[model samples]
Target chain A: MTRIGRRGAGLMAAAGLVAVVGVTVVRPQFSAAEAERPAQVSVDEVEELERAEQILIQRCIERAGFQYMIVPRFVDPVPFTFSYVVDDAGWADKHGYGAALRRRAEAKVDPNERYFRSLPPTRQEALATALNGPEPVGLTATLPGGQVVQHSDKGCQSEAQRELYGDLPTWYASTKVIQNLKGHRFGMVLGDPRYQAALPAWSECMRDRGYRFTSPDAARSEKLTQVVELRQAGAEARCAISTGLGALVRELDTSYDAQLREEHQSLLATRVDLQRRALPKARAL
Target chain B: MRFMKKAVAAGAILVAAMGGAVVSPTSASAAVTAPPPDGHLYAWLDINAGEYYHCRWVGNDDNWTNCTDWDGVARNMHDRASSVQNRGYTKEVNLYNDAGQRGAWRCLSRGEFWPDLRNVRFNRGSSETGYNYPMENRISSHLWVSSC
Candidate 1:
């Protein structure tokens, strides 16, 4: 109804809300169905332990790409949440010190998920075995309809999960659990009751390479402006930023980059200019 | 990587959300020097006149050009099989669908033509970037020249 600047208005998206009916008209019993729906099926005590170990192993592989265990962190740019995969070893080596980490969630898996408590040590071991070397193994959890959803410990990237489940919450938990365990066990630390023990070891590894580690939560917070600047200055800080609530970053993702290049060619040039100009001026310690 | 491809898909969805015509892939003809008086001479290559009108094409140079009709209203929304500079406005613009058949359409942006010298000289596609590509060829008839 209202207009703003020429192109800016065109680019703008409507934000303010108006009251609207819930989708009850389309799916009348939506809330009821949710209540009646079967909770996520928990695996057998034997299977739970294997899955946990598998999760750790997968994290190790993911961290190998980063040169060591790096935290998968969340980045937001409106519309979606993004997990920025960073190279921990590269950052530590380049910065010659660990960057300050923020606080992280104590539990990787959601407390309310069906299998959180049911994960037995044996199942955790099976998971570890599946993740240690190659090929993805499928684990099935039976749902309410006598239907089973097959989940792979390895083939689960953020995007894949998004496609399969469509619901953001499921994708978030499953992906974080998978990426977290793999990262911890393979490159940085082993999954143990003393898993938190790995934090100090991580600090030492980062310290040896020159990073200053702190709380994982702070590392994922809005305080990244300075760290981003350091990264742009070529420090490549080891981003152990935990995957805080996975949604996708709407604008900063690759899709936006291509669109800017194609539909809005000039903006591509502008972004390049901004990165070039601002990056060099950023201070790196 | 799959992440990058999905990102590209998301970008296209965004373009659809924004309502700007995504550039179609096709070959655009070169600019024709003289636009006939009766026929509307569309400026393809950016010029002072066309730039004044906020008309430009996106996508590969081959397929698309975002332009307005003679009156500065968006009339023909079509792929640039040949750019306006090459072939002046046809009486009836042809539209094509994915099946490559002519399709019915409606023009998107239509307002009274405001032919401003300042607006003409500095026409940037996206306001964020003030990029101006001058239209080389001029309409030989309507001479609004400034005697400096």
Candidate 2:
């Protein structure tokens, strides 16, 4: 692949993908909005629930006779949907996987961690109890493969969870599989022949732009110089789109999501009901 | 390795991709299962008696035994329980330290695996606010509650 120059910029703009001006890399609309999908709990929904949890935890801590400061929710420069797959060339061009977000998140929590550490062990235990309940107590389930996990209904932690998702243990089991399935989905995508086939092209696109990274993750490493990092990331993002990795994986994800929904239609129904009930309660926080 | 106070959901067999940069797990067929029977909130005591780990399930039988079951022929071991893992499919269970269900109670939410019973510290006072004390092995009686 020839090094992309003004020709590449003009070509991308002509295709309605991006517009590059000097050092500026333009982005297309986020693809998650490209389709109107069935309603499941969105990342925004989960984030809201989490923020409510933090508030409740803070309150619980205060009730335990210690002052607890609320930490800001860790913000990612990229949308939650985009985090799983760097399928957005525009996002990558502007922010290489938003690696700085990790540091930002850490900085946000440092004070909270410090304050927590300052408490005496007894106070610490009290705070933990107030927040988590009397350690985990509740249900133990065994899966067919000898893998067992437990869910606890104890503590303010569970209380906060219950506020968002009714029927806490059931909700947890149902919603939890969604996360597990997703991890599996990603693994599947990486293994698919088409995605594997496209990687070399993505790597070539990055290489043509003077970056020698073999993968987008490598090009997006935060350790690199900010200027060089963004440049490489931008190049990889454009390449990812040009190679059609974004659209391909998006299709795969949608398909898998549908299959899982069908397989667990019963659980999904409860999940939808719980999340709908939860949204308003979370907002009330 | 740091003590992950957080109970890890039984570890997934992780599949690494792109030279291990992108990591994801193959969906285990076992991740889904039918709900437990007896319909009562189920709680498990995780015991590591020396090198081996043992899990004991309690509170599902018609006459589930606990410290409060004074009329029972046998009492479920109390305080010997090291940690609790709750598998209550739908409801929350409360674990108590004092007999007759009248004392400090801990609510175990559903689908949560807490690796340690000694995880909570509370102050031993007369009311909601008190001095801090650890709650490991002190559970005696418990009741299912509406919420934790």
Q: Pick the candidate with the highest TM-score.
A: 2
lDDT for B115 in candidate 2 is 41
- Tens-digit lDDT track for model 1 on A1-285? 122244235333211111244344534444575456433222342233233333443454355331112233222111112122233434434432223321122124222112312445344233222222111112222221122222223322322223333443344333323322221222121112233443454445445546564322223323245446345323223323322111122222444444323553443333333332322122110
DockQ of 1: 0.01
The residue-level lDDT of candidate 1 at A156 comes to 24
| TM-scores, each model vs. reference | 0.15, 0.51
The 10 consecutive residues of candidate 1 chain A with the worst lDDT sum are: A74-83
Off by over 4 Å in 1: A1-195, A204-212, A215-218, A226-285, B1-148
Candidate DockQ scores, in order: 0.01, 0.06
Mark the regions of model 2 whose C-alpha exceeds 4 Å error after superposition: A1-59, A68-72, A80-90, A110-114, A139-147, A163-166, A212-214, A217-227, A277-285, B1-148
lDDT of 1 by residue, B13-80 (tens): 44454475532211000110121112122332222122223233211122223445444456323321
lDDT of 2 by residue, A1-285 (tens): 132355457656655644334333332333443234455778877777778877886776676677766665434445644533476666666676675654454344345545645666455545545554552335333322223345445656677777667678777666555544554455455557776777787778768878786655344333477676567667766776787866777877777678766876777777777876776677766
Model 1 lDDT on a 0 to 1 scale: 0.27
Tens-digit per-residue lDDT, B12-96, candidate 2: 2221122456422122212212122222232234421111122233342222244321122244645444545444323456665
**Per-model i-RMS:** 31.9, 17.9
